[model samples]
Target: MARATGIRGIWHSLPLERYTSRDNYIWLVVATVCIGAFMAAVDASIVNVALPDLSTYFHASASLVSWVLIAYLLTLATLLTLFGRLADMMGRRPLYTFGFLVFIIGSAACGAAINLPMLIVSRVFQAAGAAMLQANSVAIITATVPASVRGRAIGFQGSAQAIGLSLGPAIGGGLIGLFGWRAIFYVNVPVGLIGTLMAAAILPKDKLSGHKTTFDWWGTALMTPFLVLLMMALTEGNSWGWTSPTILGMFAASGLLLVGFIFRELSFRAPLVDMRLFKIWVFSVGNFTGLLSYLAMFGVLFLMPFFFERVLTFNSAVTGLILTAVPLGMTVAAPKAGAMADRYGPRLLTTSGMALTGLASLLLAWTLSLHPSVVMMVIELVLVGVGLGVFTPPNNSSVMGSLPSSRLGVGGGILNMARSLGMAMGTALSGTIMAVVLIAHGGVEKAGGPKGPWIPSTRYSLYVLVALSLLAALLSLFRVAEKDSSKHESMPLEW
Candidate 1:
């Protein structure tokens, strides 16, 4: 099939293909990738509800309970850059296939966990699999599809993830209510098996790069300890005291390792991540802006459910239903925003989206005094949902389009890695802040009783999120070209 063409005559942002006997199987690939992406995204949301269940199951302290989440996030964070490098070394197909298998194993272990430590360990394994899948899916799709249709393909793929994430609470709550917490883990088994089989059949086999690259063993070595230490410090610092030897040591070591990793990447021949990608104005600004934006967006998601159930006095099911607006709005708006970015440019859509996102954050902050009304909450959340729907696709397009085709594999990997880090940092940071604030306010008793301190803590967190969103808007403004500038001006990706 002759590929579709757009005005600039360079083809659309990505490739396209006509369905053929040989190509009928492409849908299988789409299904496979989408399923994996959806699973990873949904798990993030699903587990939020399961934490209490897990806490009870293990009879652990709040600090230990929190590690159930922190451990998974830290592991995923530590592995993403490494996994991206590994995919560059090994074929994406094999790595992608193996990811699903690993995920299945992790899920089973989680379902059958005998103790809290075991569950956290299982989650670590699951996170490893998730990183592998996330870093490779976009690269795989870009490789298989013609660029003419790439935006649509990626848009739909992202949409699946959005829907899955939106529905996660509903699914997890429903499964947990009916069957038990174990159902959440068991749910992934069939999907993992199917996705594994399809990926093996559709994705072409290829060998790891034979070029004698060393994989930046030093970069990988330092990064893990850096993230683990940082997250551990953040999670435990309040309990241990910021000045406590343990917290101070972790903080100090994390700083040293991070600085060491940065110097190592800049000096390495083939760095684990191409540090030079930071030099591209769009790539740099877009990623930082997006990261901060995710910090706010997911911070809200992580904290809101607690507010809904405890302060506002709603049930878990209702919280899930109300939160549904975010994903729903994203599902509605992403493709349209993507299409507009395709026609107009990423500048308007992304900046405007983020600006609106800031507005939503402000709305929540403004309304903190009032009791949570489902209607008001839904409306504010809808704005957030719409803003995210608008912001993500265009920003993603700009970042991904800025790269050359050859680098798509690694570039896509790095992009997702940044997102994962932001997500982990967001939830962990907010959780830690919420805990500290509540304790400081009146030793957790003033916040609330058995209900929760969600109102006070969430309100404070929203203020922080609002500031972050505004910063994101400013970053987007700086990065995106003015309407009069030539956005498509040829620039080498060799920076």
Candidate 2:
């Protein structure tokens, strides 16, 4: 039977004519993606501020309350590649629109939760939506926009994400102060609704390559357990004792699962992640550098609140406001960096950015004080943000631009996974290092007063970040050689 070629078919055939002008439509896609990016970034940080309130409300221990964050991050981290693959198969438009709806529903449920379990469950669903949105955000932009402006578009998105993350604590604190912790979740409902409608209306339809698509069930099955166990071990190692039986068991299990996953991917015709992508020097280096960037970024983010609150005697509100300098600097620098990357290649910009970041880390370590000057703190943070801001756009552009359109979704997914993994590692590493150092000094209490004890640990962690940043800078310098870098030059959009 012949299918009726009705309104749906016509709509698909004449997409651009039906919508706004091509340039406007491209910007619309960028705007829609930025909204989703902002929401994801905001949610990632906003919940941290609300954790104490939730702990008080639920009368739960700190360890249990911590799962609220862990569950969401774990779910998000593991499923990013899965969702990105699905976006390629099923079409990014539908997946992205559905993600917004799912996020809205999850946010509402979280706001209405009656217990910690319910809240945690809602967060898992929230993360699922987040994975969907993040997985497709870059792929969609790369597909829709012209190559010339792609860096600029990606940079704007980065700025939006940074702004959301940087402002989250302030927003969360204010909402919790006035309306309670529930308001933190409820706040996303309206924004999510708007994003959903915008995505549905404006996103370009997926141009499937007519290649036969197949799912790598075996690969996915092995991969999921590997990630879960590995992340659990990393996240819980500090509290659970790194050498404890449970941690050892998780490491062993994860190692075995990773081996199985590697075998499965090697044999499978359509692997969940095409491991061959790593063979491309640009792709591999870009992802690694990105991981280092986030590792440093989140390490700083995780440690700074403690510095402000305990060392400087600042309140939550003050700490959040002070933290805003980081993203403010990012927002200011990112777009210009992107445009510069478009004019020149990413090599110089990214290398310089990482070098600046390393310098800032060293400066912060030297300047760190029990009672630090506010001006100095702000200067260090702004420098870090600016460095990251300069590094992000060009690096992302190179990664996304390196792959063919067929692999863009997966490439973006892998890129995002690196970021999430870096964040998880950063938080865990920073906390664990500080705790160990503080303990070595006979605990925070025995060393001196609150600020006095923490300063050493903090200084040591910054030194670690300086090393990471320098390594990243070294990697960026080799990302592409000057003569052979013509491949990164802008070309016409295929999608």
Candidate 3:
């Protein structure tokens, strides 16, 4: 007990903050937050690359093994809002610090899993930890950083996430090849520990409101099941048959729950989500366009792997390398775009970014028919990345900037929830479109197996993405122009 007390004292007494000036200190906080962002993003994609090895090792069917990914997604999606609100009510520092500890423990558990069920369960635990981290990251940035450089700080965090996501496949494949599938999970342990310490040491102390507020337990109950049901239905609709009773029931139930949740929030004293935040033009439109932006981005990501492997006949390594071009472009563009948004308003940058992405997607569709060279393909993908990178930071800055400091947590949660929904929708939509296209063309077997159907299916899917991007660009124009950062800082939320 004495040793424990002594260690705790030492932990609390670390004078890390004294080393940096105020301006530099905020960037340090941003850097610390990026660790969580990077780790969570990495795990999301890393497990995917090792799915085949996991199936073989466990002697599980592909359908059964997919739950490893599905379980993580469902769990992460369900808890983000809850934890985000908790950060508001409780405090971000403790929640974020604890999140790191939980993530580390979950990573270790995942690495040590001996059976398929065990692995799936461990993934759920890991995702919960990830939810905690993600829920608080943007809120922390919003509260700590100066408004002048907010976009740039958010851009760095986004860049970290993009880089982590981009590297996941390469890292997972290399780790699996060198030390088997477990290595991918094991890799998080050391990094997570460093993040934990950094978070504890560097993060600003949370400022708690003096008045006690009730947690919207009823709101959470309704919202949680609504999201789970909605996500399950969206993800499984194709496999379960779109019109099947099971899928229909899930969708119906989810819709009713959503309505109930909306009603509950409107009536509650302290709602889970402040319903009035939507009244702000920037908040509502930003989220809508944010969803569309990710929908287009992930749609392309989902379709490209199939196109690369089947149509282009590329190996997994080469496909992974080529795919990195998208995120590589994002990494390069996000910081600069963010800094630009900080100077000029988000309207022009966001609108131009999505327009660029729409043009790039159209070009990709055209290139698909031309049997384009590898260099041309990579260049096109990079252009798409640059567009998204440019769009995301500024858009996220606008959405987050529009919120009051008191509501930043829930706002950030809603922002991330939109992103998750967009990704799920993108994957489902792209796959469904491809399947339908192939079906119309007499199916894959009838259309000369893998090669023939893939090109047309992928081309059509890219066309849909182009439309989505253009629509997002149109929506970007609707946002009320911000003459200065002070406008967002004092933006009124109609109650």
| Candidate 2 segments whose C-alpha is farther than 4 A from its true place | 1-30, 48-70, 112-118, 138-159, 200-211, 342-345, 400-406, 440-452, 482-495
Model with the higher lDDT, candidate 1 or 3: 3
The C-alpha local distance difference test score for the whole of candidate 2 amounts to 0.78
Clashing pairs in 1: 14-147, 14-148, 15-146, 15-147, 15-148, 15-149, 16-146, 16-147
As for lDDT, the candidate ahead, 2 or 3, is 3
lDDT score for residue 305 of model 3: 60
Instruction: Name the runs in model 3 displaced over 4 angstroms.
Output: 1-31, 47-74, 109-121, 138-159, 176-182, 200-210, 310-313, 339-344, 369-372, 401-409, 435-449, 482-495
TM-score of 1: 0.86
| Full candidate order by lDDT, most accurate first | 3, 2, 1
TM-score of every model versus the real structure: 0.86, 0.82, 0.81
Ranked by lDDT, the better of candidates 1 and 2 is: 2
Give lDDT for model 1: 0.74
- Best model number under lDDT: 3
TM-score-better candidate, 1 vs 2 = 1
Question: Per-residue alpha-carbon lDDT of model 3 for 213-237, expressed as tens digits?
Answer: 5678998899878876776676566
